[model samples]
Target: MEGLRHAREELRPRRREGGPREDRHRRRTRHRQPRRPSGKRLHRLRRARGRERCGGPEVTATIAYDRPVSNFIDKLSATGHVTHKSYKKTSVTLHHNGGRLSHQGVLNVWKTRPASAHFDVDASGAVAQYVKVNEYAWAVGDTVGNQRTISIEMANETLAPAWQVSEPTWKNSARLAGWLFAKVIGERPSTGNLFYHHHWSSTACAGPHMDTLYDKVLAAAQEAYDHFKASHPVRVSNTEPFPGASFFHTGRKSPIIAAMHHRLVAKGCDLYQSHANADVWGPGDVKSYAAWQTKLGYDGAAANGTPGETSWDKLQVPNV
Candidate 1:
């Protein structure tokens, strides 16, 4: 009992303000990181430590933001999470994985969970397709959203408290979403068509940083959609209306006449030698029209060089 009392007395001084042990403890902790409060700050510190241990925050791979069509790798997931039924594609749903996961990492997770997205954008912006866009992906946690939307899962450059996505990931996502919107839905991404996972579900999927940048993403998507539309114009049927017989009078210089000449030449009825399919309704135009009429099983007055509505319509003259 006496020895225990003596030991307690010796340790009591160490608990005092200016004790020897407390001084040594202070010296040891002076150069060390300060004790962080148990809240968002501490959570971030732990996340930073984990990030450093892996490969630092920044992704090293250099993938182009606007990659070619061949760059889309198909790393399709198992059929368990994908519904084979085709659905009407109406919107694009953006998401953040909430952790630093690679293209394959996201797939691995989906294997266990009953969740999957159509596409996964890695930290370097490399895209891996998991499900066909025509089919439904078991994402967005809502049946309506999953059935109508093409979900894109993006990798985070940093972990939670601020699940920040890399610049490449977001940029590539915007361009890809734009291309998809244009090709599938025939419209630019708008608030009505483009959505976040949280928009339909109970989770904050795109995170705070990406949530604020949805407007910028929509802008970028619109630009890409416009470029795509310009590059690939819609093909309309080439059925021009018949311009009537009075429109083809002699000495008349109209683009309609030039178009008719070209069609005649294409149909092996060309007799133009000196005019070279010019817009003027000269002897060449008459000869070409007479040949076209003859080729169309016309005889005598019907095969005359005068333009007729039936033969003119049969010529399939294109608009100027």
Candidate 2:
């Protein structure tokens, strides 16, 4: 009896009578991230733990944020607690909002639910994030998939497979996926690393609408990536920049040279003399380049049909 009384006394805090107890769960451990409102689109990249993992391919091997197509971290007021210790994000799983829900609608509903997702694309082409990229969120309703995938909830115009999202929404989602694949994953969508919610759960989650738009969305990701690469053109590796000399005169044969021909063709140059999409620098390539040069106010030797930095910049030749 004495030992029990001592234990109780020791455990009791020296607080005043009727004092209020602290509520640990209600503590303000959350803070809002700064929002930038300028462009029609929004993109944000916030790295945690000083290490950013790759998502898919479209960029370098060590994937970094290459101006995410529209990475807006429109975080919800409340997010679920992380349920796992460690996770490896291997793929992107797409889910439908199940209906035409707005961004706020999803956030408000998710605030009380025991669930969250990395991103959500609404019918307005708006992207709202409920979870951080470096942290895990309650999605997929399974262990393996949830621990190994970034979940994306795509908003639909209707539940129908034919009208999965509004044209803008579909296009924007594709652009977002492209950005994620490049920034999060290190490659484009392939047989590996892309999935529907149905792939993980028994429910027809993404529905026929997503099923019909799956491939198209993937294609848009590719197009978005290509457009990004075009604007930020990198030098073709192992290939020297055009030396301000004519390829026809030097008889240079190189794959980079062939890629140049492709760009010239795309630039509305008549490269019939050169085999369509040929890699080697041939007389046909020179003829086509000469025409492009002439169109740019060059005449005679200046229009000798050789690639120059100015012309190349405007050509938008992809780093193939």
Candidate 3:
């Protein structure tokens, strides 16, 4: 009996030899599993994903982050910081000769003082973008006006008696202004959504030079608008006619009809079928007008077919 007990005890320790191998197998399986990324590495991955989705560099690398803020409160108050409460710019306001420095010198001045403007027009008519379109800068003062306006400062010493905005400066400013107006207001520069800083504030910004070259700036603006219209023509209806009017007599060349025809053509409306020209208002134009009116909830009756304030309002035709 003692010999059998001794042999059994010796065999018991050898039987437990498989425990080490089982533990080693578990350790290998744990090591092979993937690890989760954390900290700065994870942040970088998330930012790259965002850049891919937005079709451009992430906001932090763009003009959105380069804007200057004086304090924590100023940073908190900056526009475009929050998506929900973001400011929607509606108009482009022009300024000239206020900075008392040439366009080339403006950058140096900005570097020292940290002033911000949406755009700066140089004496030679070059344009410099200091801020992004989606954010607001401290260019304009009136709180209400600033919220709705995008300011473009032109390099000129307007206070100086000899200062005059050069032709290149005027042309560039007009072009930029027109582009912003078309993008925001859905209207061309000729439609007059572009305004001077003086219009919004008591100070003369674009200066006296703007007064003389106003027509030229407007013409350049019109060119920009034409380009926009050609690239992105919008469809328009013309059921509405000028108020206090019956059937437009084809004999008299009505300005209202002319304006309507021009707008329709700009919008890519098929005018070849009607054979309506700008010089004459004719019965053939009625179908196109009626279609627009019907879209605007006016019945096809002649009484309702006549263009009125409601129709004009719906078409958004300027100066009807």
Candidate 4:
């Protein structure tokens, strides 16, 4: 019995041994890796630019944070902070990791590699930040290019001919780029500002998927930018109460549409016959808008219920 107790104690690892405790823990933890949350998950990011459109419910960014990649003195990037004209960020460059690595797994690589980026998007549409907007991230393997552009690294679904990213990842990347454009450039995402890593590196870093789907991504980004602006409305001197397009053709509901409805009612135009609520842009709103246009002296096809620029201006839905 005494021999059995001594044998059991001998097998137990001692803390005073020359080897570190982590060595033993590493061996023990090998098969018990930490699990990432499953399914399509979303997390919101609170940035300096997110403070706008504070009243009512607004669309905040659904962003996730991985461990940061680049750290600097006083929390600055390679050449200071990101800016409209400072970083030259003339464009948003896309790249593929060329492997099916997790977003966090890519971060681990970037920690030691000579290159890094502002953001990394995984196959599941999860985004991880390796560098901040205020600092420069090494993309395209060039100093000048890195300083002049914003980088988004994507994880490929596979290697070779398919060298592609999942649909969700593509959408998330486009949305992120669009969000960045609105926040930093103060403009909508356009083809002119969307680019590929190959544009600088002369290598197919973005892979065939981006090569074939660049246009689609740009279009998606444009939609996202428009959606962001719509959700975050600002009352300007030229603010159009009907949003950008006509309420008649509008398929979505907005405060602007509600305002348009109230104005149509005030103008004594016969809106929809059902007399529904303001949250929806129904046939009534369209019919009433057309009538309002006619009252404003827009005749013929000019007042076809569609909000033309002239009628939109004349409707005079005051900016909220």
Best candidate, TM-score: 1
What tens digits encode model 2's per-residue C-alpha lDDT throughout 78-119?
Answer: 344445344656778778887777767777668777777777
Judged by whole-model lDDT over C-alpha atoms, candidate 4 comes out at 0.67
lDDT of 2: 0.64
Model 3 alpha-carbon miss at residue 27, Å? 8.2
Off by over 4 Å in 4: 1-88, 233-320
lDDT of each: 0.77, 0.64, 0.59, 0.67
- The reply for model 1, stretches above 4 Å from the true place, is 1-79, 233-320
Total backbone collisions for each predicted model = 0, 16, 4, 2
Q: Write the per-residue lDDT of candidate 1 for residues 88-119, one digit (tens) a residue.
A: 89999999997988776887787788888878
Predicted candidate 4 versus true structure: per-residue lDDT over 1-320, tens digit per residue: 99999999999987765577777887798999677644443123343225444643343232322212222222222233332233645568888888987765775565566566778876546566656564567677776877767888888866997787766567778888877776665677776778888888778878887788988999988887777666654422444422334224445444557777787888887666865678577777778888988888888888777777677777686543
Residue 40 alpha-carbon offset, candidate 1, angstroms: 65
Q: Which regions in candidate 2 have their CA more than 4 angstroms from the true location?
A: 1-77, 81-86, 160-163, 226-320
Candidate 3: what lDDT?
0.59
- Lowest lDDT sum, 10 consecutive residues, model 2, at 60-69
Candidates ranked by lDDT: 1, 4, 2, 3
TM-score of each: 0.50, 0.47, 0.48, 0.47
lDDT of 1 at 150: 93
